[model samples]
Target: MSLTADPPSGAVPATGGTLTHNLVNSGAEKVVFKVRSSNNNEYRVKPVFGFVEPSGTTSLEITRLAGPAKEDKIVVQFAPSPADAPSASSAFNAVQPTGNVTIPISAT
Candidate 1:
């Protein structure tokens, strides 16, 4: 059971202003995904936290607020969810993530 992101390039074009990436849960059980940005002050991530059922897709939208680019990156972390998981924040606090996927940002 694992999670993967599209746009293998992991490209967050700063000039484009905003970009969307889909997080797919390939696991058989429900999984919770937490999306985070290295520079939270400069970028806003929609639904920073969420859940994806087995074989489901969750879209992660990131919008860059007018700021010069640095060594910023978007990180996606995941952990299995309980049958009766309460909320994204709680579920995340309960289990340790199996892995992480990082997307690098670039200004072009």
Candidate 2:
């Protein structure tokens, strides 16, 4: 699974960036996301990846931190592991999980 966005300039002025997505575990394990970036101006991003469990709904959250925001773009990758890839909600769900989501973080 993967999620990304091209936020308009000044979308997160005080902070850095934001991320939101829905994951669905079709397999029988948990999904793990591997995030990376290039030329990120050093903006601290907090990423949360997991399923809601029982509900089988999955989601990933990326939060921007306060400080000098990086000018780099973000990249996120998800790989369903055998031990954690059964519940979709346990990670994320996709009412449509591959598009733009509201920015929910800001720099202090």
Candidate 3:
């Protein structure tokens, strides 16, 4: 499994920029994926939690809630089922046998 985001980190424009992230699951079993911003007040993530079928792919979008911000961090994590209990809250809170990825965002 892997997670990636475009424009990893940079200054935020006056109109803000849309962050596009992709998550890929190559395992044979289903897995759960989650996305969260270190500072929710500054950044927003949609469909915070969802499932990724085996050999499937998913995408997420993060948008700046306010006009601009100094910096922020977005986390994308995945946890395989059975071994790691599932949760509706966050993947960070769950046991990540599959590890995670963090992307940084900053403002100009």
Candidate 4:
């Protein structure tokens, strides 16, 4: 999967705020992306998993719920969609995990 995240990093209010990351897919095939955070207890991510068509783009919203606003990271796991898969989300059923892209997060 030829994927990348922009802004490299994100900033939110130390007290509590929301941050968003844009993911660009430049590959030739569709990809299923699973989003997660290093600290799930302190943060919430939307669209935990989804799919992106080739040359398409999608956004992930990472909102800091409550914490000291320390540095954290978001993990974006991606795998190519299988031809027979009913949906992109099912791609995660891959026999093995493929790749991941990490995005740094911090409180402003």
Candidate 5:
């Protein structure tokens, strides 16, 4: 799992900013992410937090996608999303693509 901040570059914790985590296949070959809302009084003034599934094998990194209300700083957790699409109520799981796929990440 990888942790990343918005602007796809330097660190800038402000409103409408972003943080990203990349999950690539290794020996495990699968991973998941858990994001906690930074929606505190401080963040309330500048609310922003989101995540995206990494789909490539390039150097791991996190960047932001197109959306309203960007996030700057973000806390991230890694686990598994799912190999197959399952119900939201089911346990978390994520599938690692068989080949190279670059999953661009952003705050959506």
Candidate 6:
């Protein structure tokens, strides 16, 4: 039940670039998670799919746009299934226990 993003420093060029992240399921049960950009005007998420098995790993790619003349913060939210949840799909139904991470984009 751990998540990490590459360029872990969370720094992206203002001119836009590709951001990659990885999620790992450390628990003994399957897990499902969803990803979305906090600011769609500034960033786009590709292949917005979520499904990861126990001890499984998945990655997501985000395309950032160049705009907003200042340092913009975009949060890539990840909501995973709870431990008691039957499965990834059920987790969404339960709608509890989730996590998120932020990315910093410098419009240089």
Instruction: Give the TM-score comparing model 3 with the true structure, all chains together.
Output: 0.68
Q: Which stretches of candidate 5 lie over 4 Å from their true place?
A: 1-10, 13-28, 37-73, 85-90, 93-108
The whole-model lDDT of each prediction reads 0.79, 0.42, 0.66, 0.81, 0.35, 0.61
| Rank list by lDDT | 4, 1, 3, 6, 2, 5
What are the per-residue Cα lDDT tens digits for candidate 4 across 1-108? Answer: 688888778888777888878888998888888887888888898888777789998988888876785888999888887767775566666625478889988875
What is the TM-score of each predicted model, taking all chains together? 0.87, 0.38, 0.68, 0.89, 0.32, 0.64
Q: Residue-wise lDDT of candidate 2 within 11-92, one digit each (tens)?
A: 3444445555454444443445444544345444445443322325454454455556434444544544345445534444
Where does model 2 exceed 4 Å of error? 1-10, 14-29, 48-71, 84-108
User: Where is model 4 more than 4 Å wrong at Cα?
Assistant: none
lDDT comparison, 1 vs 4, better candidate: 4
TM accuracy, model 6: 0.64
Model 4 error, position 68 (Å): 1.1
Candidates 1 and 6, the one with greater lDDT: 1
Residue-level lDDT tens digits of model 6 in 15-108: 7887776666666655556565656787776545466667777776777778755565545445555667655555655665366556565555
Q: Give me the displacement of residue 83 in model 3, in angstroms.
A: 11
**Best candidate per TM-score, number?**
4
When summed lDDT is taken over every stretch of 10 residues in candidate 3, the lowest stretch is 1-10
Tell me how far the alpha carbon of residue 75 in candidate 1 is from the true structure, in angstroms, after superposition.
0.6
Query: Once model 4 is optimally superposed onto the true structure by TM-score, how far is the C-alpha of residue 42 displaced, in angstroms?
Result: 1.2
Q: Which candidate is the best by lDDT?
A: 4
Give the clash count for each candidate: 0, 36, 0, 0, 21, 3
lDDT of 5 by residue, 1-108 (tens): 443333343332333444333334343333344333343333221212212345433233333333344434434444444556444224233433222222222233
- Rank candidates, TM-score, best first: 4, 1, 3, 6, 2, 5
How much lDDT does candidate 5 score?
0.35
Model 1 over residues 39-81: C-alpha lDDT tens digits?
Answer: 8887888888789889998888888876664667899888898
Model 1: CA > 4 A from native: 10-16
